[model samples]
Target: MKPVFFIAFLFFSISSIVAQPTQKPLLHGKNWMAITGKPLAATAGAAIFQKGGNAVDAACAMLAATCTMWDVLSWGGETQALIYNPKTKKVIAINAMGVAPTGATVDFFKKKGYSFPPEYGPLAATTPGTPGGICLMLANYGTKSLKEVLEPAMQLAAGYPIEAQTANSIERNKTRIKEWPYSRKTFLTRPGEKREAPEAGEIFIQKDLLTTLNKMVEAEQQALQQKKGRKDAIMAAYDRFYKGDIAQEFVRGCQEQGGLITLQDLANWKPIEEEALQTNYKGIDVYKMQSWTQGPSLLQALNILENFDLKKMGYNSSQYIHTVYQAMNLSFADRDFYYGDPYMPPVEPIKGLLSKDYAKQRAALINPNQNDPAMGPGDPYPFENKTNTYLELLKKRSFSTDSSDRQFMPTHDIRTGNSFNTSTDELYQDRLWRGTTSVEAADKDGWVVSITPSGGWLPACIAGNTGVGMSQRMQSFVLDEIINPFNVVAPGKRPRVTLTPSLALKGGKPFLSFAVQGGDTQEQNLLQFFLNMVEFDMTVQQATEAANFNSNQLWLSLGGTKMEDRKPRTGSILLNDNTKEATRSELKKMGYTLSFDDRTSGPINAIYFDWKHGSLWGGSSNHGEDYGIGW
Candidate 1:
């Protein structure tokens, strides 16, 4: 997509709309901005920027650090990113998502008595993607050496002070971690004691993980010593991880633990850099990753919302919430059925799916009065000159219209939402990322990056001495065509994932780089976050902290192995506890079964380019470990 700059009039930057103070102070930077899931991780990005590396380099640093800390992800998880390369003046999607390995198929899962892939263990893993993701980004767009970018992560692995959130999670899941001997040895510092996991502030060390990172760095160094070009040297490291001893150990460990990945699977897996999917909303070009991720759902949401007068609706007003929720329900409904591995597909009618005519058609189906419990995927085939052959399958779909209060939601009320509630949050999280994390970075050179990486999380099973946790992304695949033919488990095909990173451009320049973490709830929060800045004029920080609502009107992308467990809870809405009682009552009247949580802030992180001021505005969510550093 060409940069649609030279709009008749320029959109104003963040202004008085953010009159209310945000919980986190706005971070301003004239040269660089770095933000992610943890303070240390962000700091790692900052260090890279200080070292004169570009946005891609800093983001790679942050990715490595978060994975090392198991900040909702591990080395073996997936990485999906959207980067604005100023030199190219284009948004590029990094499809670092791994594919289901050999022997991973619907029949394989069914015979194992699973309706879906298991939530954890080797069975739930696809090939690891983060290592390749990091190497690729660094080699292509970054000026830094792999050795430099990995230094922070390597340091973290050698024994960084562990935080309470992660430490406690390890303690709580010790039983499950114990099931994997390698994991037990690494995570459970005191196997037989009351607390097998390390305590808060303890210097948690991963000797094996450090060694693994060192090996990759060594590979890069060896290639460099041989006079290899920077990119080739990084690829050398990439090859070592995927085709050398690393892949061998990972395969041996995986098969030993009942997983399907073969060394061939690791060798064959490669990351793709493609043009980002785009849609114009009021002249701003918004970009998202491909269908393999849920990113496009946000693009579709924006298309539908474009037809509404959101500014007049007022932020969080019953009408606003209802309209936005309905739009997302429409978008996610389509995402559930149609989004999948675009590389393999019953070719997802993506061209048709993003067509304005199709968006208008979907928008027209939204009722202004109440939630549409029967919301399902729309046929985009006609827009692309193909008759939809799966309309019959869509009709056979099932969802709950009961609107009953789910005991599960209320339990995740204020306390659960404020901080990580190990049990349900862990489940809700990869359930990731029903478990995942986000990374955002930008530099004065116009380079910007947004990444939502997920998969291997706490209680993660280790892959032998590789110190890498296997990915649970395989759980994202469906076993039956009735659920999603495009997303059914198949060897060498990617599981449709919840990870998405977004970028927006106005007047032919980078306007925003942002992403968030939450399983299926990703696009819902991102859609609102974007509107908060564009429609409501909230500052990036204000938008990041603003209360948002979630709709559970689509099939969950993560969770259990049973079809019933992944079923949609129609008309169920998660509202911030701070919502006015009247607003809550009105939503209730609109057929929404409201659940309250104080922190629906997305744990969102973002960098907004204020061209007029020639500065970067950074925003990190007011909850969890999300943090940012700007300079």
Candidate 2:
């Protein structure tokens, strides 16, 4: 062969022989590690670890930083977390999700001509939760003081180099931001200029937010000086935020903007710490948050998926995708109908939903040949040996297929056969794949934490001088009984949220801790990530970079001002562009309307406990700006 041709041939052969590599390198550590949505926030967590804090303390630091950075969430948003305590040898769930305020009933919204909760503004808010959540986690689990944990966030609030992602989001949503006086004052650095938001790399300072953090730290300091214990001191700061001056200012600002929250509502709200739900996948015990957050659906899907030989089907194969999609659809159907605030009336049938027998019954309904678009919530009440009190009501509930017209209320969108409406498709997609930041941390002391905290994203309704953004979580509730008797809108009820964190334990030791961004796609991507690690033997980094698909066959848990906007698209699937053409063809033949993306592995972040090597291996995907630090 000619010399030039031979050289070209050698290069081609080498490229073809080598396996594809991950965009981000795998992280390795011996003592501890921290991972989150942004570089600075991850650095914040790392700082806490360096200061000798445990995983819980580091996780709190990361959470505060992410909220401060406006990385698709804020301090007023809800926080859902799963923490593995080394001493207790157990995983615990932190339910810091806020409740609806007084006058936030179905009748109140209907009277105002709203089909569902408004997508944005004061009307959509639940009482602030993240502030209380941080205090609770720090008080009960963390070894650090509130002053120590809030240091990084307070610094960021004072001023930090803003990234283009958040800066540009503010610019784009400036019109909405202007509607709220405090938001306009905090976000619009240049009132009349063409570029009102902080420029990328510009120092973005939030004086009001900084003041709030200072007040919290001051309250803690005062309590400590008075000889209060660490936990008691933390609770003192919590009280200041909820029942003291902070709460008064927050309520005044909220009501000024036509919101429903009251001082009583703020005082009544408190974070709950409960036993985390778990399911044994093979010999590994997987843990998730409770049903109120669409978390147990992942467990339910795991149970249904347990019936299949997933490894035999091959990862991302047509058969694998089909079976997984069917399982998720079934799990989500039950979630839409039965999951609700357990603290209120109409107790959720959680025991039944998590039952293996119920999973088997759900699994039996899946069609091997194609998608079953008419699947509805199963009768799990029977599995628990109790009569389904709402069988008649469930019967009255409308069921629709890909081409059927359906309605739960007079204002619900009326479908007209399979003539797919394209006008609102973009908005629908936005809600399905909406973004949120994830936090994961672990230490050699055997502490592990995974959290998927969200709400109060860009265009937030800033609550007065407090500088706290109001949560837009009310949209997750239904206004009608027939649609979801359990999830109906009512004062003080928590909505069924999409934020879910995951952890797995093997042989009574930490195995893996993981979480992802994206609304309804949260569980879908997490399931695939877990399977890649457990069944396919992929490394944590490789699993995060692997291709994953999303199903739009379930109702959206975020956004959408009307039922029409939240409606599910039967048989719609989002496939990674790397998907095999053969697999796509097979799915298309089975009644799926497919879409494609190059990045679908969740922008996921994870930590794998390499017990064999006695070390921690971290994974951060290339899909987004997720970063991790290890030492």
Candidate 3:
């Protein structure tokens, strides 16, 4: 061969090898890493790992950077996390969700004669929880000093570009931005000029945020010099932000703006530490955050799915999609009616609802061809058929049934009956359903991570000052008598959140860590991702890129502009061959109102450890406006 031809051949061969997908290695010994919504946040964590910090340290660094860069997502907002240590094989759960101030009362809202508002301003604010959560994580798990971990975030905040994501988020919330002075000053360049969009590589700066972080670092150092333990020092740092100088200013601003938060509320606030909610799905150990939000709802959805043969039923078949929608509807109804702060009252026994036996029973209620408009909660224990007795009891309760037109169900004619089903003998089978046998082993190295961050979109826009904007979060519902349908309407009552962060393990080895950002779609998106990974056997990227779907079955009232009476939401279901033939037709036959949009589902940040390859693969969703991955 000619010399040039030989060189070209070599280059082409090398490129082909690099282009093929490679298995990620399992991170043995100790691995430090972080995944966030912004590149700068990831950079901070990577910097910490390079400097000899562990996961906790990297998390702290990432927390600060995320707060600074993705102000709407982080800041003093609440956070939840799962942290695992390999040597000890222990996982701990952290609850960084915000709480209503003590002075909040439902009666107060009743007297005002107005219903609760859902905007994130002074009216929608809760006590900021991110500071406390970050501090606690560092105190319990970190070896790095506070100053060291926070330095990166502080520097980045001093001068970082407004990424396309942040700019878009800012523009979307422009009306709400006008509620707070600080938000207006920081985001809006002029009084009447349209907000500018930042180019991809442009650096955005927030001098005020840098100042806040610097003050926090200094206070932490001072506390350490006084011989306080790590926990105490961290607490002191939090106090500086919430109850010290910042607190006084924040309280005053809220008071002047007719908000309800008080100084004592800020000083008395503390992050709750709770046991993680756990379950086993087809042998894989699935873990999630508990009540006050929708964490348990995902478990309920999974449990319901387990009762059905998803793959055999065919992907997204009308029948399959209808079943899944029914499951979500049932779970969501339970979430709205029963889920609340555990401190106030015990949440309903959701675990039992998601149990295998329960799922089987629930599955039996499905009428594959028709819409069951108002399926009541199934009896907790209806195993033995009491036909006579059950009928008599039903008569006493004045039971009634009604048929509701289906919305969002697929049309049977959309796909020619192109069955992808292989015969039992020809079916490609691997140990896909081996069950999460090694999940317990993975738990040994697991960490419980929970984040419940809050922001004051409306209040901050109106307030203008950073300090003033921070106060609005605490003014949400605190009254016992207020009838706020969503959690955001009531002060101290937790917001109905879409803040699900999760981890999955196989064979006592760390498998994946994942999270996403969407107002009410967080847990729903997560449930789909989990199903895609386990049941569908998809790669991380494929699972994320796969068309996503969600149902408006539960909070039909909260569907906003997307709500429909006769059709199920369309775009929620992916239009793949498998789904088109199976889910779409079956669901249409069942009758559902559906609408379709080409919107990105949600952004999922994930780290997958491939034990077989001895490499770690990290990925972030490119769909939802603002996420990316790096080596």
Candidate 4:
């Protein structure tokens, strides 16, 4: 063969052997930017930003829009957000998770002849906090009125094209919706129209939801007519749901169905604005909601891992994954044992958990050669409370229920049969269930908001004629209390939720605003994303597309389970096929169960601001219906 001809042939062979790398288009802008789990919502939010609304205004708009487009998120569920204000240089955490009804108690279920609370219907519903939280955010931070921010979502609720993903969710939950008359009438059927499930690309109209949204708008207008300020008008809109006719119907629905909610619970409920928890790692300050969530678990894990050279370990290497997994397992063990509502009795101080010395103490527990199947609770009790028996404190709210591995809500147990007869407390029997739409926006003026709104869909039971429903967050509360004092259910106490959103600052300036809807895995993904940018020097888009993994080694957070069942599994790791085959096999040989399967990677929507260049770069996981929009 001729020398030049042979060389060309070799080049072609090598080129054909190598595969092209798939990359998602990264969104760039200067004026403003928004990313969300749905395109319509992102567009709606961007429109708000274009209409002179700031980040908070855009977030509120996007949140409601997500409710309209995605069956997984609903206005009637719950929401939590972290907003960073440039003027004050402060990060505020919004804890909008609903609280158990005032009547909720261990005895409440026992009286109904059930061992524990049912995971569905009115029994498991909490006093919803999303509406109050949205209004509060708008009134306190946003420049636009509630009527203005909600206009796009209101129009969307009236009618929009149903997408395939949401259609499938509706199809699967059709039977559950049929269990409740209001849910059946409102979701499964239209005016003189009936169908098994909505078809993709069909014009889906939510007349009932539209009516519900209009009532809040009218309430806002009525307050405005009363010569009220815009802030008061927003609060009035919030009140219409919790204190006016809407509350009446919501309470009545629960009462008629033998549920525990009351008018008092609705009248007194308010979403609180709390100071966010923060920890510094590698020059970036990470912020999260307080202990009533899995937020601090991220902080705790970061604290433990900060002692090591994560960059030296290399990204997703066997040592890196094992070390991070062990740290996460340790933190989650502490989370399961101690994290809970701060206001509730027997609350432990979080100061000890986030302390550097404490982190060093916990970091010493990671075994280099093997995954620890059981890492028991830590001694986070401050020096002052060293003698406190945390286990005894949790015993105050103890009860028993069938446990399962499903993360969030209960799965239907065919053994019990499907019956709404809570009289026997077996209502959730045979009722299989499961379960963020995220929105982020940053304006030129230095305002940034990261919000994750979720809950109230077809699987959720609707309140009678109110076009509202309650979140199943009550499921997160321990039916049978264990060592985790913070998670025990109490009247008016918020459940320690998995709905965590996060924000960060670099050099005391707004740097990154990001979040995900992966339940417990949210923090794991966020940690990797942040490291990819800060440690490995990857762009926001490249870090987002980096190979991700999830370890189910720890006890699931979203649902209740037995103590024995809470031990970490032999460190199950689920990775994408893009991960190197050699790395996968190496990790498997290290006693880690590895699965190279592609599943729905949670949309890790993020926006990174380069203040020096005045340029904004945004990335979205594009999972299902996710999208990023900027201008």
- Can you give the TM-score per candidate against the true fold? 0.94, 0.92, 0.77, 0.88
Give the alpha carbon lDDT tens digit for every residue of 220-301 in model 1: 9999999999999999999999999888998998889888899999999999988789999999999998899888899898
The 10 consecutive residues of candidate 4 with the worst lDDT sum are: 408-417
Q: Identify the runs in model 1 with alpha carbons over 4 angstroms from their true place.
A: 1-17, 399-401, 404-415, 418-435
Off by over 4 Å in 3: 1-33, 168-176, 192-203, 376-493, 556-585, 599-601, 624-631
Clashing pairs in 1: 429-432, 429-433, 429-434, 429-435, 430-433, 430-434, 430-435, 431-434, 432-435
lDDT of 2 by residue, 376-489 (tens): 888998888888998898888774545333221111111111222445453322222235789999999999999998878888999999889999889889898777888899
Residue-wise C-alpha lDDT for candidate 3, range 140-208, written one tens digit per residue: 787687888898888877676665434554555567666555666776654676654344356666666
lDDT of each: 0.85, 0.86, 0.55, 0.74
Q: How does residue 278 of candidate 2 score in lDDT?
A: 89
Candidate with more favorable, higher TM-score: 1 or 3 = 1
Q: Lowest-scoring 10 consecutive residues by lDDT in candidate 2?
A: 408-417
Best by TM-score: 1
Error of 4 at 567 (Å): 5.8
Better of 1 and 4 by lDDT: 1
TM-score quality measure for candidate 3: 0.77
- In model 4, residue pairs whose N, Cα or C atoms come closer than 3 Å (at least 3 residues apart or on different chains), thus clashing, are 340-486, 412-430, 412-431, 412-432, 413-430
